[model samples]
Target: MLTDYHVHCEFSDDSVYPMEDVVRDAIGLGLEEICFTDHVDYGIKVDWDSGEEIRWRNGEPFANVDYPRYFAKIADLQEKYGDRIRIRRGLELGVQSHTIDAYNRLTEKYPLDFAILSIHQVHDQEFWNGEFQEGRTQGEYNEEYYREMLRVVQSFKHYSVLGHMDLIVRYDKAGVYPFEKVKDLITEILKVVIADGKGIELNTSSVRYGLSDTQPSRDILRLYRELGGRIITLGSDSHRPDHLGAHIASSMELLKELGYEAFCTFENGRPVFHPL
Candidate 1:
């Protein structure tokens, strides 16, 4: 079955595309299954410009998904499109070391088919705006990012997979941070993830960012395989209709070339694999 496990819709603050439009577009592309992993980034306080704590809508600075509305809409869509396509309710959680309790509570409170643990910011500083990389060399920021990931992975256990393991490289202003520079730390993070029965997603957004590589890169994929880690998932990380399911077939082909025989989908927090 062709499935895209990472997707964003209207529920995500950064995305303006309606959830229904995303589902319709996925159906048009012949996707059998798609997961709505909308963003839920709590603990983000800064404005990225003033470097001051922000208090926006509902007294929260960052855009956190409205769980009640999000889940209710997913239930309705799932019932409406059950015969046409499989829709899974999921969340892209921006995990921080200090907010583990909040995430734990949220996960326990909801019934999520899948959850992606992503590090969107470090210490409330976003990488996209260069706040996380300022005053630091590429190597330093790279190592810091990996270390933060390792710390969170070691502590948090609610997520199904780590989203875009090398996401920091995408926003690095200095240059592409070499894998060798942070491989050791990444290995540790991967080890913890595998040991805890978690997986990693092959985020296809690299093409969107003109990276010429997947989020974690091909070398990291090889290492994950070499370490006996096999729970892999493919996602376009698309925020809009046009990008939905983008590059998924190519990503599966690449995984097959790398000796990955199968990729995964989640339901009720359990993984189910399909041959590539």
Candidate 2:
């Protein structure tokens, strides 16, 4: 079964596609299931050290989320497409070290099938928010970035899966942060993720970005397997129709090569595996 867990519809601020269209595309791709993990980013604080190069807005980050309407639409899709495909209600909550209370509240209030906890912004500056530009050395930038990600993983423990472990490298056009060089940092992050019993997602979006084969690289995948990190999920992280199942075949092959015999899916907060 092809299960793409991390996807966004118009409900997410950065995506413009409607939920119905997203469901249609998934069915066309021959996927068995797709989960709509729309953005739930909240809380923004400016960092003075980031200086003038940084230009962005700050507020209750996902203040636009209309919970009543959001859940209503999800219910509509569930009834309309119930026989064809499995549509799971999910959310991608942007979390920092201090946002644990808020994160817990949102999770508690919802009947989510899965929750993808992510670290999008760091040290009061959003990674994609234009605060950190492309000129800095990858080592210097990724070190700081990974450190904050580790802090987020350590602080927030309620999530079912860690979304895109190395997503900070999304904008590293230079490809300077080789996985071998940062093996120690990556290992530390993976240890915490596994120790906390959180699953890791193999987000295929990195292929579109022209970066490493997978978000965490082959080395990280191998390490996860070696460390007994059993719960793994696969996703296209698709926002548009055409990209619904992007690079998924290659991602599965990578997992097989890394010694993983199966990939995972969630229902009512319990994981089910599909054998390779």
The lDDT per prediction is: 0.87, 0.78
- For residue 16, model 2's alpha carbon misses the true position, in angstroms, by 1.4
Over the stretch 1-276, how does candidate 2's per-residue lDDT look in tens digits?
A: 777898888777667789999888888888888888888765662222323232333432234345667789989999999899998888888887777787787778877888888888765567774476455576877887778778888888767788888887786666557777778887888899898878889999887878746776666778888988989988888888877888787788878878899988888876788986
Best by TM-score: 1
For each candidate, give its TM-score against the true structure. Answer: 0.94, 0.88
Candidate 1, 149-220: lDDT as tens digits: 988998999999999988987887677877787878888988998999999999998998999677889989
Judged by whole-model lDDT over C-alpha atoms, candidate 2 comes out at 0.78
**Model 2 Cα shift for residue 116 (angstroms):** 1.1
Per-residue lDDT of 223 in model 2:
87
lDDT of 2 at 155: 80
lDDT of 1: 0.87
TM-score of 1: 0.94
